[model samples]
Target chain A: MLLLAVKGITESNRKFLSQYDVTVVTPDTITAQQIPEIVISYAWDDAIGQKILANPNSKLKWIQTQSAGVDYLPLKKLKDFGVVVTNASGLKAIPIAQTVLSYILYFARGLNIYASRTHWEPYTNQYLVTELPVLVFGTGRIGQQIASHIRAFGGTVYGVNTTGHMVDGFDEVYSMHDYQKALAKSRVVVDGLPGTPETDDFFNNHFFDQVNQLFLFINIGRGTTLNQNDLLAAIDDSRVKYAALDVTTPEPLPKNHPLFDRPQVLLTQHTSWGEYVNAGRTGGLFRLFEKNVPSFVKSGTIQYNIVNLDKGY
Target chain B: MLLLAVKGITESNRKFLSQYDVTVVTPDTITAQQIPEIVISYAWDDAIGQKILANPNSKLKWIQTQSAGVDYLPLKKLKDFGVVVTNASGLKAIPIAQTVLSYILYFARGLNIYASRTHWEPYTNQYLVTELPVLVFGTGRIGQQIASHIRAFGGTVYGVNTTGHMVDGFDEVYSMHDYQKALAKSRVVVDGLPGTPETDDFFNNHFFDQVNQLFLFINIGRGTTLNQNDLLAAIDDSRVKYAALDVTTPEPLPKNHPLFDRPQVLLTQHTSWGEYVNAGRTGGLFRLFEKNVPSFVKSGTIQYNIVNLDKGY
Candidate 1:
């Protein structure tokens, strides 16, 4: 099987792939004549991916992404082409959950105030996470991991999903239609929803206006799910007490953007998934790829992380 | 019974104490001739406490402190006066433990690096708490709470006390005499030991030299237990990767102190115990006072956090 890896796999991983009778080629080494049957790419390589997809002689049957979110991929085109799509879901769960906890505790313990202090000024606006009732927007792998961690700290976890089906680790689950009740009780709101047309601008003025009280806001999921202007207004009106965003629309969000300078905002530049050591090669992503490869070789499909092309994850 | 509460009791608490037949008086109301049988004071009321204790006609039989640590109190003099001392131990456990976790997660998620960033710069030095093995010195209420929180994140918790006896919430327990092995394996070290003569400068240069690797140091314990210069030297030599101190000797540690300016150090200005809402009056201290009031009124002595005046905790 010919596989084209735009980036992320290491030299050692390339050697490992050799044992599977799979030939791996990078963008530097790939020729127009050598159309790969499988392509492994991350979100940023879309331009190169477009060129390969446009090729009339392209033999691509499946695209495996290194990112949990495949929002940046040409989903409709891939759907039309009948190419199977699988993502690295659950690969970044641990680190991303840890980052979410960091944001929660950062605001809970007033580290946001203490971090910039040059003199001895004790802050008292802090509260314990145990007192926080958290409402997580998505109940998938990442949200579940986050809920488990919050539960460990004796905090209440309220999960929201398309269906209100109860998930393990969450104290309660609310469907999208009935989440307003949970939202009213939660002191902390976390956005773990993926970026899809349905979710784009989901957290806008209408949503912020429903918040019952001033609360901490955290975004570890796709940034497109939020309206940046609405969030700023929420902060201005004291509906959102503080916000820690690991993801933002137009990432590399302009250096002079208003969000960058707000004391109530903590922008991490989407580095939540960057923490895992050698993430692409020996870490979770590689392990996930290793699990899917043998099955993909025998059949033209993968069972794990198979995104519904029509619905989009 | 007459009780002198220098501070911390609210008007509502005073009314509640009335049901117990206890008359609460502040410094302004307590005349020299009006010697109270019991006193409630915090760490900062030492001068007034000294004056009250020096009154030869004093009927003072007990001192109930709002602080967990009694290091600032006149322990020897209280012992000489045959005064029983009880502190608000376990009261600050939850919030203090939350603050400790905040410190751990802050560094683990690279907030220390990203916090100051004005532009989009992703950092890769972040690691999950699960990857860190923590060794906490002192397994009292606060330490155990800290252990449980770390363990919840799948991190190993090694506890150290005077005895090596196993404690709940700790993965392993080591005695002060034999903590070197645990220390060597730990990537994060926390000082939760109380301030006492024996614990003075316990974390000196000799102690820091025994560290096996570059580690994160956290002090939620009394400041006197740590030797600041030794810690600074360790940081300079790269034996200590980062330090987050909630307690520091002579805090409001001088505004120009080197520790305050170091990029690797996070000085929290002794605010770990300050986060509780209305901490002095309606919070933990007052709750503790209420619990102990009934027992003290029924007998000459009360239980719950009785301090060995000679030991100074």
Candidate 2:
């Protein structure tokens, strides 16, 4: 079987994957006509989607995207070819969860404010900071992990999920319908949902206006899921004290971008996932695939496969 | 039975204690001449020590100090009176352990430096930063807790104790004789030893000079146990990169002290045991005491209550 290794898998990881009976190919190294059985598309939003679609062969059994979201993938075309689509959904959960908790704690206890202001003077007033209650959207693996860590650090956690399945560590779990209730009660709101037509610009002017003005917000999932204009207005109106963004629209946000210049905004260049210690490794992915392949073959169901094309993730 | 409500134990706590067949008395409220069955002294420093000694307590059968350190309780007077001495020895273990781990991650990963620096600029330079290892002194309740938390965060943990008992979480547990060896290999050294005559100035200039120059050190134990001169020299000679002190000599470190002026130093006015969310009620110590009191009454020996008068705690 052939597998495409995109976004430059580490040399150490590549060496390990070479041991398996898999031929690693890059988009530059192959043509659409010679479609591999397992097409590992790194940039789901790029030409890779078209490339896979061009190959109308039933031989292309699986499309393993190196991302949690597949909004840009040609789902209809893949379906036509009877291609199963699996995603790197759980891979980013650890780092993203860590980043969310870091920001929540930093904002809740005013650590960033204390660190920034107390440069020349001794920290006297930093002692008066108070704790915050957090409401996290998309209580999937990433959100659940975030809730667990935040609860461990003494923050009250509430989550919103499609199914409203009660998460183990959250103080309260709510269905997606209870968004307004969650927002009303939270001092901080974290947007961790995938970008879908329904979810895009979910944090617009109306949504931000309703959220508590004292709320500190964060977005680590999809950048387009937020309305940039509403976010700026929220910041200007003091509705949102600060917003720490890991993923942003127009990636590599230009230095002069207003969001970058916003006093309360912290823009991290999509580096939340794949950090220094636990960067993406193909060997780990291959091991996951090894376990998943037999189950899929037996039951005709891909465990992490994303469906519901309209929902986009 | 008589129970002395020390350490400003609130009327609420005293009321709770009164549920048992015990009478509560404070030092200021009760005369020493009219000594109760047991005198609970919270502070064992010079000022409090002289007060206790001034009271010739002929009827005092037991002395239960709220502090873990029995150094200043006039142990000699208690010995002369044949009074059984017990202390709230493990009260601060969990909190101190939480603090130690907080500093371990903060220093090892250079979180403090990053938090202190201007993170507005993009990050460059991709070389291995530093190896993280922590050496904990006094492998007692607090030290072991620190080790457990540090190890949980993927740090290499080494410990030093009097008995050299094998601790599960630590990579290596060494006796006092092998502390130098442990220190030599550690990236950070956490002082958790109680303040005794033998431990006073325990982390001297000589000891600092023997370790790596890039090392980080912290003291969450007794402030008087450390030599300020050695700490100053360690910073001056570049033997230690930085020192995070929760406890410092002459508590509430004077405004213009050199250590306060040092940029590398992070001083937290010995407030690690502040009544924060989970900390206000660290029931571990109380639970241990409540459980062992009956056992002590039956067997004449309590677990973890070994206090040697010669070396005070």
Candidate 3:
């Protein structure tokens, strides 16, 4: 069954589900209406968590989310109701990693400036540019891929990971707790962390204070992980020159939000996942549902199921 | 030695005896003064031919140019005078090739348009882009390097050369005769041809006509290879979507040039060789001169030494 609560997927996704035996159910359709055997949850819709938690009579057996982070989903409520929770992981790894590299190259070459019609100067070509080091938080598959691509372009790649294993392309890899040292050494910071309670406010004023001038910051993973106050303070202090965020807290971030009008801040409407337009993979949610239903029913445990209680994505 | 000439090196080129021993001289610098032992001519300078043809100096033993193209340097005049001409060939291959790939990515991913602060709109995170088919006009060292770098970034590379030999990273290789067909099929074109009478207007209106609307043209070789009138016509016809030029006739193309006003064109003041500003290499001319002079004096021939007076580099 298709779920409307998912933030990034909607009417277009429902059309794709029609190809299968799935039917879309919006918040209106799900209430005072017939219930389906399964209900999918989009990571961005936490309010639906309360609705699903309040109605145990519908007998929901499976809960699938369209986002990689399942922390926001009411995993405890789903678990109490014996509902299985799974996420749309691995799907965003490549695209998100590619987007990270795009930011790196954009900052390194000053390409955005060069490509602009206004900055198009003729004699200014004789000027030189200094290269800055990039420090990436998290060295998972997406982070490794980002590091490799950045290194290919003659960039020094540094990363922070739980294991701190010696990765191939990273000039230096550090433990997660050692991020402070990495920040001091880097002029560019990329946040690609999975959002959990531990991750919220990971990039705060303290983090920004360590970044050098003209420092660039980008976040593509979770909006809640960033502290709006900390980011604003950092920009005000001129410690961070610019920030390009794909994900932000309270997305469709209010018009009056500081980030929306902040100088040097490029707030994207979370397009890192939008490459699917040309990829022709918009039916991903339904496809994932179709693939997991039978297994979830037979095994009583989804193959890629996420446990909210354990907080493991 | 640095050579700064206006029109071309003159007959008095052989008169500057001590000026060039440690200093650089152009045709302009030698007019009212004595001729230096060494004269530097760049491929960008079309006036070199006139200077050499007018000078009948047998004492001029060496000529060095700041340009990679040796075609315009008076090969016959220097040969008859037993003066060897060395070129600054390999200096710009890397940066020029990098710029070429940057343009390819800019076109293929539509980054050129999206990166614009004034033109960009909020886009969904699920957008994907199709790759472009790129054609390199000259499959020499710079072309080969450009093809390699572009292919590394997941681009299809096509190359054209005199011999049509197989290149490692290119999907297709064609001779000059097949260039028209190649141009017809490719979405992007990069011309690195030398400025010879034969090559003048190589990319004329007819060529621009064959280019598709998706075409992104780049010229890093000599400006004469592209006819200004033809390029302007192509821009008007909308045959080329974006054009990035590092070299053009009339270096500092007049302020009133139509291209300066074209929105689709990005003009760089032929400074691809300014690698030193980016901490790449310093004093490329002096290094090239020092390395090739002894070899030219010993073997009486130099690599990248252009000879065909009819072709005119």
Candidate 1 per-residue lDDT, tens place, A196-270, comes to: 998989999999998855568889889999999999999988988899899998877877999987889998877
The clash count for each model shown is: 0, 0, 25
Per-residue lDDT, model 3, residue A244, is 73
Output the worst ten-in-a-row residue range by lDDT, candidate 1 chain A: A35-44
> For candidate 2, lDDT tens digit of each residue in A135-224?
888887888878766655555889988878887878888887767776777877888988787788887898888865755789987899
What's chain A's TM-score in each predicted model?
Answer: 0.93, 0.84, 0.76
TM-score of each: 0.93, 0.72, 0.78
Best by TM-score: 1
Error (Å) of candidate 2 at residue B243 is 4.6
Candidate ranking under DockQ, highest first, comes to: 1, 3, 2
- Report how far off residue A20 is in candidate 3 (Å): 11
Recovered native contacts in candidate 3, as a fraction? 0.23
Across B1-313, the per-residue lDDT of candidate 2 in tens digits comes to: 5554454555555565556544666666766444534533332334444555556654455555555667656677677766566676667665555555445444433344445433344332111112457888877777776766555444578888877888877889998766777777777888888888778888887677786674578898888778888888888879888787777778656667877677677666665553345443333344434444454445545565656666676
lDDT of 2 at B45: 36
> Looking at every candidate separately, what fraction of the true A–B Cα contacts under 8 Å does it contain?
0.69, 0.02, 0.23
